[model samples]
Target chain A: MTYDPVLLANIDKKDSHTLPVYQSGGGYRGLRRALEDMSPADVVELVKQSGLRGRGGAGFPTGAKWSFLPKNHPGPVYFCVNADESEPGTFVNRVQMELDPHQVLEGTIISCYATGASTAYIYLRHEYPLARRRMQAAVGECYAAGLLGENILGGGFSLDVHIHVGAGAYVCGEETGLIESIEGRRAWPRIKPPYPAVEGLFRKPTVVNNVETLACVKQIVDRGADWFRSMGTPPDPNDPRDPGSFGPKLFGLSGHVNRPGCYEAPLGITVRRLIDEYGGGVWKGRRAKAAIVGGLSTGLVTEAEFDTPLDFSAPIRAGCLGLGTGGVIVLDETYSMIDFLHNSCRFFAHESCGQCTPCREGTQWALEMLERIRAGRGRLRDLDLLREIGETIGIMPGTTICGLADGAAWPIKTALGKFREEFEGYVKEPTTV
Target chain B: MNVLDAETRENIDTIAGRYPTRRAAVLPVLHAVNDRLGYVPTEAVVELAELLELAPADVQDTLSFYGFFKQDKPQGEYRVWVCRSLSCAARGGEELLEYLCEKLKIRPGETTPDGRVTLEFAECLGACEAAPAVLVNDTLYGNMTREKIDELIRRVRAGTHHDATE
Candidate 1:
């Protein structure tokens, strides 16, 4: 590898999760720099200059998101770390939290400082008990070391951080849904006019960022924006607002691979290179048929589009929503497309928050159609009906309260369109359901 | 009768104080009771409602929204969640579940006759690199196999699930 890994550097070290080991490698230097040298506005501007984007599926610019908070909000502001990584085929956040928790904690403190947030909460998934234990230990260490409570390192900024473990609800991974869960309510996502930045987390200004996104915040403070921008795809010169993917990303590899694990690589590596080079090619020397490159929601990638760069913008051109989380699940020749689609659709169907009719009913209906097709009982129009449900259910179609519908829709719609022949083969008999 | 004792009440109070609103303590309180008793009983729900200053129906409403909390009865001491998501599924996760079910002689959501372990299928344990991962309560066991399952079960039966993870 040409470039050195920043985020995952400490993961392999023994006791790397401890505060001493983390500090020995200059861990809190990023927070120290932010608190000692930079003002809140300057810290936010530096992050904006770094061009860091959210790594939790959505590729939104992080610094611009922090700037959305009301400059003079009378009440205390809140920051939420979205550690609810329930996305299938994605587990890098879990690895980060469990192995090198201080980085996450340091990043959280810096994020709170930059956003003027007095309190922060990491909404960790209930399934991640090890991560919770490690993070709890790390948070305790920080408070004891004068890096968390009241005046931090003689800097006047005071911040309180808490870890709120979530029950098993996939919808809580959504930003608004996450806010709802934090408020101790159902994980149903709320409408976005009074966005979380404006009215969120107990009706105060809130900024919800992903784990990887915050790690980038610490790195940006440690190394200048130019150093961070040396790697990754540069922003579009013609398109003014496009903040291109910069810095190293944790692209996780699993399914039909010889060595299944998370590896740090630049953002623009092609899906084929990711699987063959990093993942040690497909196991059993099998040929790759298709892949869900970015979790289940980003849709499937067929052989023809495998060479598409796994950057923020390029995934859409390959028929996915974007490079969501960069979690690649490759399907080899033996794996059935129908079974894979059914499983992916079933995940969304089971996990919908039931707040909207389109997602609640459409996801279930889509699953039924897939089941029928898998059982050799599908009609040709059923495929068209599935496509219709996909088009009508998600945020892209303007029919739901949140993007969960959009996530559910992308793969079902994309798979039906891209793998038309395979789907058509199952629907040979024109039988009514 | 209030099922929550003084210790549970104290824990709930401290948790409620952590958040600005008493309502925000609902999950923490519920999780605490659920983990301790191995299930959130209906009686405990009403008791927790009073503690958190929430209505009984509101508590039940929120509790019902999540899949993790079991209200009917207490599960076994160990809750084994086997991953069956796409990444795990592609690598024999379904078969692994079936194998565990057959060996335990109990289906998903059912505890063993001795009430030692409760079996369930999980979406994804997020340890996908380990492919077919099995989560026993808080600890995740990766790269599962029949031998590992046998050792884990033996350890669980002996009341030492954390010992000899290999």
Candidate 2:
């Protein structure tokens, strides 16, 4: 599997919407090849070997994720592109969508053929108007070229791509949450066990994949899996990135950095390199204070661990941060830990959806305490209350119908544990809320 | 406001036609209306319901439940939506939102009397490290500052920023 970064090849500073240009570069060739030459199994096999994984923050193997669909469940299997990329720090999907939407459309068409799906849904966030426009145009272009809809590319397979925009909700980024939203419900997440593949949107067998993951499939089928594997840091023979980690990943760098945008780099690239080379190091020489590896739900790692290679297992092994959404956020000296945690708690509280009692009450309680501490009203008990709130939600993971409780709980728990001292000091010298 | 012109309606209808289910076209209709009117008004919601053959209540729920739907309230001519998600939050999204409010002399979710700008908070505009970022209507102004936000509002109100219809 080659990591050519060609997916991002068409990006130009002067021209953000570059789908037409991507077409000239043979962008949909993979979809063409699959429709004309291969069977669905062959397409799936190529992706399976390519080691592609879900880029929608989960990192699940793309081939395996598709395989979860029942082989003979029904005829109308569905492919839902999780284009609702609202996870904080994760903006790579939008860049890819805005720049080369045809690539996603092409990949989606191929995926539909492989999974025997006749219908596909691209559930995008409503906030991304430009991306929605680009994607809509690209889908239109694909339909014009006979690469979509009935008898695609004259290959005798019919596929239709629909772009559904979500009202804003971070939980909607969750696969089930997205499914529920597409079904015209409030964007609350549903319990797993029936994962989207089993009973997704309208209770059908569906394959919901991230925008980046689906795009990778088009390239894998076109270039072959071995070439794709060659570009990423080979899994360590001695201490290789775990079996779980594989291939080049698209990293979205943001925060206190000079240059911040999307970059397609190998999975094991160091956080230091991302901040130093790609991010142009910390701004104004303030020095890197802390970094959030994935997104908000991911645990925080301080500057001392910046060199930790960013692989699925590497960050966890470093024991500082959780591999959130592969969104590396660098915070410099100007950041206040107290206010930062309050802001995070507030987001969790606001987005809890109140489905589960623990998440509903606990997030609000935690935010209140964090807010009080930030507002200089912190008694020592406020820190303890924050800890208690985290504990209550921590036990609510499998208890809740969805993982939202767990998602909101994990960060609070991790933050309280990791930055206790900073939180503790706020009890004595709190910053105004 | 029936801000969508005939050509815009045709374009929007084309999107609605692509979906097999009328419910699927909800987002496209809202987008078309928002693009044209700068927000989804009650009239547009009713129009979307008629177009999609769904009840107006259904469209209304969809619009109000989702945070992105800017309703047809008296928004200032320009709106500043600041990102307040975890990534941005961790790196001073709150302070930036505050800075904008102070600079514009309007709290979040409040429209200035002069109709020049309305400042509001958003949940993650997706550019986290560009923390302190704000979306001025459709365009993203990353790495935001009070001065930059003020400059953006002045430019938009002064007819310098690209109009949404463009």
Candidate 3:
């Protein structure tokens, strides 16, 4: 299957970050069309028909998420564009914001219009100083050109966009956590049931969408829903269900790959093709030993599963987790699975917001066991203990306030389950001959 | 000691105006204070609390949650963050960090004797395309080598390196 660059079509153009260059490539047409012609319900229905799913790990339908907002909520409705791309192996959103800030801004404006939101916030990570500057500049440009401020393009829809830079915390990427961070508090994710659509951002109806997810909205509006649905496979075959991971996705390929960068490809493309064709295959002519197909939180996939379609459903059906933010980290023959798992465990342990007991305690205990095994001081029973701890934290959903604990546990459980021998080999008793 | 000058206070007010509530501007105001002063001093926190209409403890609580803000004292002139995450680690980011430590005669998370540079390890700066990346203050230098580290150190010491924020 050939790759079609929808989100990244203008990324390579010179001066692509500027409004003029972006406009030259037929940018902001989505916002203009939606404001000039379509109603809020019409825009939402178009997206629903487009079969667009959230690009931020969870493959939730983008239109469904927007439709959750109450039509006539008395108070102010808010939209938050999640630009905090802190997932360990994910860097695609960074490229989107840095290369084409206006694309994200335009998508966000269209979303705000569809959701009837007057205020929108772009929650950016602190590490991305360059992206923030570009976004700020672009916002200023939009205001000056009558694209953002009052009565946008004389369509009688006024929206104000603000950029909020986050402090160093991985959990802020969570929608509710992001809301909390924007509200000037610690990024502890709030309990749901009063979902963000119902109540968020100072207890107002809010819609929190990822940067990449919103970027897709622009194309869905500009090209129409049929064009959007024609790209990827559907979830079911005869009388299909949800749109099965449709549209072009940005895959951040790194680790041991010859070319480690973000690649734009259609969903359901084979992982082997992604590595062999786009990533230039494994680095130094080494065979791929294992790979973390999605982000660090997703389960590991061995070379035998290399042919698995890089979509939202196939990997989960193949005993691995679903395609997360599509951050693929390849491990070569020289890489150690145990070390990789250890690093993953340490990251989760350090980042588990400590909101729930199972997550806070389980993450720390799992790391200690992994460390003990790594240090060659492991008894045979440590492996079972690690699995038990991981299952306690992750096997059951809603074990923690947020998915951080689950993220911590899935990698450990999957790594141990797949590469138990490698872990066991590290457990050596004193030379008792 | 009135750590927040008139200019910093005015900046905080402008930031507060961007949000519906003044409390929403806490992070940006703290960043403003950090930019003016090397770190967010305790006195500055007290002043910020008063400015934002909250207790000093409330300001301190928010400050403590984040690792980016330096509360106690000033950091070095050039804050060097070496990426030590999986992608960069696979590309020898740990070795580059060690090399920087050896060349500077200081440990990770510690400042140099002359207070010119402070070395630390960052999880991921979202620039995995160029692995083995180093963030000198706000600027990111990717695909770094031992020679690049040496040159970076020299340039930082000479105060000639371009700031990424600029």
Candidate 4:
């Protein structure tokens, strides 16, 4: 019922090469209005009113992010779409860019116009060459339609979008790290305070929003803010002030679930509903033993909280888990949770970006502990040490230069906290059947 | 077809203009060449390096650094890339990849003798849902199994893959 017919959002996977097709489907109409009708400040105001947040992971308000640009700073501002989607379970942005490249371009253009940014960059991961090609073609389509370049839409406003493919690095998904990668440096995060909004991308004021966040701009402008606010969960009685904080999130369902794919559901949909209703339940009628709600890094929720709503705040408050990236990974009865944790810890360890001491050493220590435990070579104290290390590094959120430290630390801590019995069970039996 | 098409060549030139020095366009030029030729050959690498005013070794280094570029040989016309990261691996990707190699009658890194298909191992293709998934050339196939891969390869080889939309 959350699916709106008006906002079905066509995925032009076919014939993505033509401008006529995109234009026929009401493309460039958002950009057209932004250029001719809305002034820069006016556009920013509309976004602020819309209550849109960044769809990447950190749910920062999109308009507030745009408004973060210092007005007194007498220089050029930039918008870098964080298309560097190297998150483990998050691949929603790739489809958003690939299926509707023009939509993304339009949103980027509108954002650039609103932000008074003459230049915008889509920093994509290098593995996504197909997406890079499609984005480039979409940019070309925009230019051909006179929606970009000099005097766009006869508004005397010129904007340029450059697609920069990043070399493979998970750290680059972090906004500041992405800016560094775009600036032709190593893909490690910079310290905040000098956040990307204040001083980013060649040391100028820059706003980095996720690809999905940018893509949502067109819908907000075209349909108006009230329309978007209508779809998501009604404001909770608990939080009357920010009822519409989290909107419809695209859940990337993976693992042993049948019909596993990206399902655009409202924020408050339950894990059980997503499994039974949207995903057709577990594959081959297998019992769902564990479900990693927000990716491998997020806590593995067991049978206790299966009916927990899959929103940001609810899962955090109830089950101590946040919907980071909205990646729901269902594990069947046969899968080994310890092995999976071991594998995930290895990934975090490998991609730590080596910036801070806690993250660099803590991630390595976690993986090593997981490896030893998985290999049936660990003492009970080692299990305690795993919990200790995870907790010690968990205190440093946004403490390191980038979020990788937090990314590596938080999941381990949460998993240890939630699944201590499972870890302990692994110690005694080695194989829990 | 050795040279890029007119439009593609122009696009490559535009990437070249982005860098202050031409030598910096090596990676971008390699992408253009790969997009055109399906894989970067020795001749294309030499030509690109020469065009970018760098040693061939520089281009080779970049190709090796990234899993996308193939330097030793050309992948077949149909390149099936399976993601081999943690999520996919946990979701039975190893078995699926093994099944693909057997069905294709080539190793994971080898192209079929007929030049019709090539199997390459990718790390986290961003399509975790498709877990045990493969990208046959540009099209993404997800929720895959050995039987599914077998049927797909058969249809592709027989030229009956009418649904091949990249």
Q: What is the DockQ for all candidates, taken in turn? A: 0.69, 0.49, 0.76, 0.28
Per-candidate TM-scores read 0.97, 0.89, 0.97, 0.83
Q: Positional deviation of A251 in candidate 1, in angstroms?
A: 0.9
Candidate 1 CAPRI classification by DockQ: medium
User: Per-residue lDDT of A1-433 in model 4, one digit per residue for the tens?
Assistant: 4464332256733564457767778878887787778888888988877777777877677898888888867767888888987777777778777777877788888898888787888888876756777888888877887888888889898987888776567777888877766654456677678777789887889989887787678778887777667655555678865435545677778778887877787677888888888889998888988777776556667756788887666666654436677777887877776777776788788778777888889889989888888888767888788777766663354346666666666567666676778788888768732
Name the runs in model 1 displaced over 4 angstroms. A237-241, A429-433, B163-166
Candidate 3 wrong stretches, greater than 4 Å = A237-243, A394-396, A429-433
TM-score leaderboard ranking = 1, 3, 2, 4
Each candidate's fnat, listed in order, reads 0.76, 0.62, 0.65, 0.32
* Worst window of 10 by summed lDDT in candidate 1 chain A: A424-433
True-vs-predicted CA distance for residue A326, candidate 1, Å: 1.1
- Ranked by TM-score, the better of candidates 3 and 4 is 3
Please give the C-alpha DockQ score of model 4: 0.28
Tens-digit lDDT string for candidate 3 (A93-169): 99999999999999999999999999999999988988998999999999999999899999999999999998889
True contacts kept of 1: 0.76
- Candidate 2, residue A420: the lDDT equals 80
How high is the lDDT of residue A10 in model 1? Answer: 97
RMSD of 3: 2.0
lDDT of each: 0.89, 0.76, 0.86, 0.74
Best-fitting candidate, measured by lDDT? 1
Compare candidates 3 and 4 on DockQ and give the better one.
Answer: 3
Clashing pairs in 4: none
